[model samples]
Target: AQSVTQLDSQVPVFEEAPVELRCNYSSSVSVYLFWYVQYPNQGLQLLLKYLSGSTLVKSINGFEAEFNKSQTSFHLRKPSVHISDTAEYFCAVRGSGGSNYKLTFGKGTLLTVNP
Candidate 1:
């Protein structure tokens, strides 16, 4: 079984400042990865994902996450953030193969962007 751990529960950053939310997973086998974001009262949205090929995946909203197999991590980063970027981010992992649609998610990290 694989489990994801988000190192920080909350990250506060000033507007236009860079931010990095750390995420780590523990698994002996191959897996698919994803990062989901929730804004305010809205539902969860897929920010980015990594299944195969490239280790780096970017979202349309300037957010990016790099899958590092060696360190078993998929950390999300952004060069600059806005006040609208305040939201809760979740790191999810799903085991490769089978028809399992279940995803193990981390506790989540709340990113609060300030001016």
Candidate 2:
């Protein structure tokens, strides 16, 4: 079975500061990792993903994550964050082989960018 863990329930940072949201995954076989963000009344949106190819993946919004097979981790980071980046972020994992269409997600981390 595959699972995702987000240890931080909430992360607070001042505007224009750097932030990192930790994510860890566990699986017996190869897996696909994803990070989703949810705004205050909006549905979850895909932030970034690690499917194949490069071990390092990035998002357009200054966020990046590295797929570490040895450590089984996919931590998300951003050098500079804005108030608009304030939202809940979720880490998910799914098996790569099957078409199960099931993704195990973490509890989510709330990022609050203060002024």
Q: Pick the candidate with the highest lDDT.
A: 1
Tens-digit lDDT track of model 2 for 45-68: 999999999998999988999999
Query: What TM-scores do the predictions have?
Result: 0.96, 0.96
Backbone clashes in model 2: 0
User: How big is the positional error of residue 35 in model 2, measured in Å on the Cα after superposition?
Assistant: 0.3
lDDT of model 1 at position 34: 94
lDDT per residue as tens, model 1, 10-102: 999999999999999998679999999998889999999999999999999999999999999999999999999999999999988877667
Model 2 scores what on Cα lDDT?
A: 0.94
Task: For each of the candidates, give the backbone clash count.
Answer: 0, 0
